[model samples]
Target: MAKYLLLIVEAEEAYASAGEAELNEVMEAHNAFAAEVGALGAELLGGEALQPTPTATYLRKTRTDDVHIVDNPAPELKEVVGGYYLIEAPNDEVALAAAKRCPAGFGHVELRPIWSFG
Candidate 1:
């Protein structure tokens, strides 16, 4: 089987404005999504929701041999990555199908295949 990553992207502002009821509904959707993928035979390897983008730290190497660290990666980027899902499937088609079933809620899900030595 091959591994795939479902990168979740969403607008943080939307999340901030959502009420508790909306959040609960989103949670239920995620639960349903989990059941749906399991029924489709997609093995969920691992996944997690990340903290807000403001908590992120970015680093880069400078030409002068100094490593620069910045707390803000891109302040102007309105859409930020919210979470990801790692899944294993027998083939690309199956992986894609599984990704389609993911409940991104207020965001869009991007599906990518994990690099394999084999």
Candidate 2:
């Protein structure tokens, strides 16, 4: 089987304004999506929900050859990666099909195959 990563991209404010009930609903949808992927013969290897972008830290090399560290660097970005799922499937078709079942609510899913040397 081949591995794929489903990147869950959503608006930065998508979850910030969500009520408790809405969050629960979204979680339930995610549970159903996971089950559906399994039913389609894909193995749900791993996944996680990320903290908001404001909690992120970034490191960059400046032109002066110095490493600069910044916190909450991209709050201006309208959309951010909210989570991801690592899955193993029989082929591209299966992986793509499983990605379609991901619960991305007001955003979208980006599916990329994991590179393997062996």
Candidate 3:
């Protein structure tokens, strides 16, 4: 099985203004997706719902051999990674099918294969 990372990208503003009912609906959808993974014979290795971008801390190495730190990515980007799911599937087709079912009401889900070096 190969590991894939499903990035749940979403518009921050949409979630920020979501009401209780909307938030609950999204959560329920995610719960259903998790359940579906196992039923589809895929292994859900791990997953997480991230906090708002403002609460994030980013780091990068500068040309001067120093670590540059920031709070988030480009502020101009309308969408940000809201959550992620690490899943192991039999093939790319299965992973793509799973990604299609993931709910990203405000944006979209990005599927990426994890490279193995061994």
Best by lDDT: 3
Model 1 lDDT tens row, 22-116: 98988897778777877777898888888988778788886657889876867888778899889998988888899888877677999999899
Error of 2 at 110 (Å): 0.3
For model 3, what is the error of residue 110's alpha carbon versus the real structure, in angstroms, after optimal superposition?
A: 0.2
Cα lDDT tens digits for candidate 2, 1-118: 9999999999867688999999999999999998899888899999999997767778888666788987666667677899999999999999999999999986999999999997
Tens-digit lDDT string for candidate 3 (15-114): 8899999999999999999999877767899999999988888888866678899666698999999999999999998898888889899999999999
Could you estimate the TM-score for every candidate?
0.90, 0.89, 0.91
Error of 3 at 10 (Å): 0.3
Candidate 2 residue pairs in clash (backbone atoms < 3 Å): none
Stretches of model 1 off by over 4 angstroms after superposition? 62-65
What CA root-mean-square deviation does each model show from the true structure? 2.0, 2.4, 1.8
Model 3 alpha-carbon drift over 4 Å, by segment: 62-65, 71-73
lDDT of 3: 0.91
Tell me which residue pairs clash in candidate 1.
none
lDDT against the true structure, each candidate: 0.85, 0.90, 0.91
Clashing pairs in 3: none
Q: Candidate 1 or 3, higher TM-score?
A: 3
